[model samples]
Target: MGGFVRANEPEKVISLFEELKEKLGGGMIYDGTPYGNLMKAYFMKGMEEEAMVCYSEVLGEGSKVRFGAVSYNSVLDALGRHEKLDDAIKLFDRMIKEHDPPRRIAVNLGSFNVMVDAYCIAGRFNDAIKVFGEMGERKCTPDTLSYNNLIDQLGKNQLVGQAEELYKEMGERGINPDEYTYILLAEACFGVDRVDDAVGYFKKMVDLGLRPNANAYNKVIGGLVDVGRLDEAQGFFDQMPEKEVKPNVASYELLLKAYVEAGRLDDAIKTAEGILLDESVAFSDEMKELLEGALRKVGREEDIAKMYEDVEREKAERAARAAEEKARAEALAREEEERKKAEAAAKEAAAARASQAAIEAVLGRRKEAAKEESPDGGSNADDGGILKRLGITNGPVEEKRAENGNVVGASVGDESVKQDGEAKEGAGSGGAADQATAL
Candidate 1:
């Protein structure tokens, strides 16, 4: 059955299992190894439901099959791989609780490690931590794999501090970290912006006789570049060839991007030339575009006409984006202008209304004053009072009556006529007195 499973013949394996079950009728017993093999076959064939059924049949109450730790671990691994993390945890718990003491299938460190890895893959970090804690309770000291799994997940999730603590604990517990451990620690340190710590760990990995690979070098260089340590990154990148760890396309691309972003166009051109010169590294279109952009930045041209189309396309995209931004800005400006205009017009309208109200209020007060002055339809006293209130006074008046009893002349303040009449009267009286005395 295992051979069949290895040969990718799941149907034949299943048929064989069915035939074996039928031959070993009612009271017969079988161990879990065959069932595990069958489950593995089902899992390999993408028949997850059938695989789970096989696992259940092994642990079923009526079944005489006794599953050992290896079989249980296999099923647990399948469950984890299938993203059935909750089921895997349940199975792990069952193994610990149900299979202990009687020792039908004792959970081992591999079981815990599998569960931890599953939880990490599912991003269930808390659950993974719980499993890690359970290892200590079970007196199962965690190995390097356990630490690496946890650290890698935590680092990827950007939980660098926790990853660092775990790495420290590994050293304290005398678990010699492998190259993978060092790589994870360096990555975690880099994730948290601890560039110096990352570099130290990377170097420490080399000192421990774990050959630093291209991946390790790339990580350190990338970290340095991320922190704007372009010079340091370039220096490290230059050392890759000496270490016999040839620079990969990613390494060159990182250096190129850093140089371009830092305005070191000359350095970027050199890196681009290195990329082009290396026959091992495939010149992908992305790399070509990056190189072309760097060349343009330094006001240089390349004979690679294939890259010209990409450059022109990028330019068109940039122009379109710029135009969209300009249009959006213009719209915003127009809105702001309209808002200001509306506010000003509203203010002007309010001012006009206020001015009209003030004028009406003044006119109303004058009307009230006029009504108070003239209670009747017409009153001379009231009119005179109004004139006096206005600082106008009536002067003296002279009147003349004609024969028809109609007043023809009415003059005010005729001082010259009054003076002449007074003088004539005085002379006439004097003449009468003198004539009477002579008589």
Candidate 2:
């Protein structure tokens, strides 16, 4: 149960508590600490309604298990999560008025920090300052965490002077600024176009034992770049190693963009290429697209025209290859067609020879039948022999009789034989029809 609550697993902790209550009777885990932990988890998970229910349940259990500053602070944090600053402030007011012994909710640094950030985000910097004053009035001296939050809020409101004042005050109070504080302050200076001021703050940040992180360098470089101070920005980039800091995407992008704006196209292209290929620097898709667009924008007209020429050359090569392939395919088709025609001619010649052989065989059989005929009815026997040789097995004699000396029983009544005769004549004539027929 404790692990679940600490891990921000609110639903699991709530179930465990409910189970324990059911098993050991109603008030088993109604203590302030358990309820407070449950409330914290619920708040962390943004389960405001559940946290409220637990708050009321614990409050109902007994005054002995009263809602302390932690409970009220969790509710306040939950309200901040929901972005209900007005409601959050109202709850804070209620806590201040209620809670016997007037327990201050300032015990939780996170709660105060969140409220300060909410005020800043909501553009209520005045209210944030008031909260800081209250923290002081309550004898709760602000730590570096508290000082960072207030400085960040003031800076976000474009109060660079006030932000600087607060920094000096932190120093006086011996509350040193952290890396985030310097970054935020540098950002504030950059936001208001205070590049020189930003540089000064950055140097101070490094002197305070806070290593200038990537964002800090980016802020300074970007500020210098924005003011067209390319030389100074380059100097900062070169000196990053001395401060134990490293350049990131923003640093490179700012320098590259400065070069582009200054018409130093070659340098811009080189730097962009460097950043684009770096594995550690994960160039955002949008940034990569922008870099490509920037190159096109900065490239000379002659360079662009050369690019088109290269594309045209490639297209010509592809077209030539395709034409070659097509020509090869057509030649192959013609060769295959010629081979098929040759094979068909050989087959037809073999069939014609077989037919002539069959005709000779039939004539030989007819001659043998004539020699064996009975001499007393020689005419009738001759008709039978002729009919047998001609394959006229089922027809009246009149119908089977030849017309104009044509072999009626031998022909199948189709014009194929006449067409074959014409085709053979055409082949021998050397005309267009002859050429087609030969092929």
Q: 322-388, model 2: which lDDT tens digit per residue? A: 9999999999999999999999999999999999799768856775666577574333335444755
Which segments of model 1 are wrong by more than 4 Å?
1-54, 64-66, 81-83, 97-105, 121-124, 136-139, 207-209, 261-263, 296-298, 302-439
Whole-model lDDT per candidate = 0.76, 0.69
Candidate 1 has an lDDT of 0.76
Highest lDDT against the true fold, candidate: 1
Summed backbone clashes in each candidate are 0, 0
Q: List TM-scores for all candidates, in order.
A: 0.55, 0.52
Cα lDDT of model 1 by residue, 312-376, tens digit: 66667878999999999999999999999999999999999998798657645654676666646
Candidate 2 Cα RMSD after full superposition onto the native fold (Å): 22.5
In model 2, the runs with Cα more than 4 Å from the true position are 1-71, 81-111, 118-123, 207-209, 261-263, 276-279, 282-289, 296-439
Candidate 2, number of clashes? 0
Error of 2 at 297 (Å): 4.7
TM-score of 2: 0.52
